[model samples]
Target: AAWKAFLNVSQSIIAIAFGAWAYESLGGTHGTPLESNLVAFFGLAVAFFTTNMISVSIFFVIRNKNTFLSVLRQVVGPGGINIVYGLLASPIALIAAFLYDKLYVGGILLIILPIFLIRYSYLSKIQLQQSNQDLLKVLVKTIETRDPYTSGHSLRVSRLARFIALELGLSARRVEMIETAALLHDIGKIDSVYAEIIRKRDRLTDEEHRVIKTHAVKGAELLQSLTSLPEEVIKGVRHHHERYDGKGYPDGLAGKEIPISARIIMLCDSIDAMLSDRPYRAALSVDQVAEEIQRCAGSQFDPDIVAVVLRGETLEKAAAQIREASLPDVVGV
Candidate 1:
């Protein structure tokens, strides 16, 4: 979020300069401190907020994770909410400006107070998001330590899932949850009980396979209390192994019976698995992977999601990007 912070700082400077200019135009330093400062404060706040909106738009545009309309909605939704408070406080600013000749340092304090609050709160929010991301990275590193060959699996799944979700026309909020679930879908495998099963090079026995299937449930439970994630997120982590047909474990949820987030994870998880090598097998050919997904649709996978990756214009591009960027999964620790 260095970019975000930089934009905020730059916007603040521009706003302050604009405010000072506005104050000078109204009446120079000869006027009372309160009125002049209030005018400056109002000018700065509006300008800062306006420019901040622009920066947010540009920031997301450059990132280009979603369509222009999607990014616009994502940026404008939060900004519109924040702007309400600014509008409400406008009257106070007007009053302060009117009483400029009458007041002193108190008005200046009032003027700076809102700016300080806005900046502090915005920075704090950014820091919190960064911390969560760092935490996810740590978890990914832990997974890598367990299976070096599978390094970057979770991140790839997350990236692919997010793009697919956005392509499906889901709202930004739903897409975010899907991305989070994708990143943590394999969390249950981190349990010590699964160590031997996970590292085994040979075929797993029926009991070992059964034990392995429990990882989905275990992962969801492990994360349930740790974060205030929605039920969709937890369910997605738990039911990612579920099939479109009724054959999946933990829950036999079929078709629409499965949460959309879980359905997304299932498809994404499979794509990553096909692209990634395993201890037992090398990565499949791209053509083979595509054929398998198409063949498995309506049975092993969601036909809709499969169609998106295989046939939809938007998702096809995203899937291609992931293929080009994804790291190959090598065998051996």
Candidate 2:
């Protein structure tokens, strides 16, 4: 991440410098030498600062490969980069045209700089997005390595949550947030408490349960440190275990007080856990698991979400769909 940030900043500076050099060389014919130099310098500085700030912010904000690419495409489209470049070059372009009597050259530069700036910003964003995705994949892999039974769990949870979000008619951006949050929801389990609990498995003592419950809080803390993750993601990690009633842990937040992203993940995670066999017990049949979920609705689970899950063909069908959607994404791991 740090390397990518450095590269992004460096590339932006270079692009700005190159653009200013071009403008100074071609547009200074009728302007006083000092006036032309100052205009060029100011324009370059503004371009550099603006692009650099945006690049760094984007690196932190976007972690998905495809989604980040889409956002970059939109920002670099005809109007996006052009807008930034125009803003940066307008003052210099104007001074050269009117005050410096370099109307023809300044006018030409004003027309050209917008396209250059837009292209530079777009390319930089693409690079940063790719780097961010690579970093996240590494982090997820590390998490999976530590929990063999739950290998690919994060990816599965992310896919299932995304499917539910889509079915619930959420906006594309909102769905994406849920998906990303699911991917990192259990990341805090990388801490020692989680390791100790997992090792103990079936024989957990009361002290162990207390330690395990801290994972939600720890996960939230870990995610909060990452300024790049969306606020919804942090909230989901902090409250995914929270029940619809006021009985859940960490903050004991209830019902609507729990974030939608967390609720979506809670359902998905529970379904996965029930469907998958663990060392302690055999995997439950789909129908039986569904019955359990149905029984728990409005108590352990959200009634509305349970209704949505059950409205589908059957528990077996829902389980099949989750497995189908997630397996390919996770198989290699």
Candidate 3:
């Protein structure tokens, strides 16, 4: 986000610098040279800032296909409104200065700059969040490259997990974190023996299953020191395979002992796995898949989450959502 923001600002930076340079070099047509130059500098700043804000806000709205009103929260709420207001108000300042050469109009905006600075702090927070999300995406994609069969597995799991999270009434922030964790949940397999066996044509032996189980713990340990992710997210990644009845691997947390995020993710993960083809078996039918989830309730899966997921979407519709939202753009992982 920062790099992209910088790219957005680069043209404005040039425009401002070049405007100032030209103002001094070409000399002013009206008012004193110093006065005209200052007006040009401020005018360009307001113009550039407002234009950049509008473009970025529009990009996000189109990219996410969110409601048009969402722009108020995403853009205007984060000081974008101030930028636009200033840009629109700049005309008054410019006109006043045009009629009578004085620093008062520009000075009014100078006073508003401190408020802009405060609003910009909020913008910075959003950018930092976007940057972390982007970095995780890059990491997830890199891991996918290592295990080609799981090409869209992580992404599909993430979208499904996000759906489950929302269904469970988790806060949006929590849902986003869980989604991020889901995308990188299988990252530990990048260097593990399971990477080779993950898509094998034959069933796994006892030892291979055990090795595959180690991935959850390995993934948590891999992320423990990152410090950027929320603790709940890491915990969910670690315990996503844990059963509701305590027979699951790793910590084997049972019932409420399992983190809610983990429980939600577990169901999402299992559903995607069942819907997709495996080396050992073909994908399960929607009815079969629903029955399987029902059969495993309170044992391998959380009964409450299972009930919620089974309420509306069938296995086929869920699979469709995953394909539309999470599939990789190209053939390879």
Cα error of candidate 1 at position 181, Å:
1.6
Tell how far residue 136 is off in model 2, in angstroms: 2.4
Candidate 2 scores a C-alpha RMSD against the true structure in Å of 11.7
Task: Give candidate 3's whole-model lDDT.
Answer: 0.72
At residue 195, candidate 1 shows an lDDT of 87
Error of 1 at 77 (Å): 4.6
Local accuracy of candidate 3 as per-residue lDDT tens digits, 1-333: 897778667756755565455545554355454454665546565545545555655766576544444443444434355566666665654555554444566866665677689889999999999998778778778777754546677878888787666555555567788888888787777665666666655777898888889989888988898887889989988998889999897997999999887887788788888877766677777889899999999888888888877875645666786456455568765
Candidate 2, 98-170: lDDT as tens digits: 5335456666676567768998999999798779766876787787776577777787788778767755656
Q: State each candidate's clash count.
A: 1, 0, 0
lDDT of model 1, residue 82? 54
Q: What's model 1's lDDT at 5?
A: 79
Best of the two (1, 2) by TM-score: 1
- Candidate 3: clashing pairs of residues: none
Order of all candidates by TM-score, from best down to worst?
Answer: 1, 3, 2
Error of 2 at 5 (Å): 34
- Screening candidate 1 with a backbone cut-off below 3 angstroms (N, C-alpha, C), the clashing residue pairs are 35-100
Q: Pick the winner on lDDT between candidates 1 and 2.
A: 1
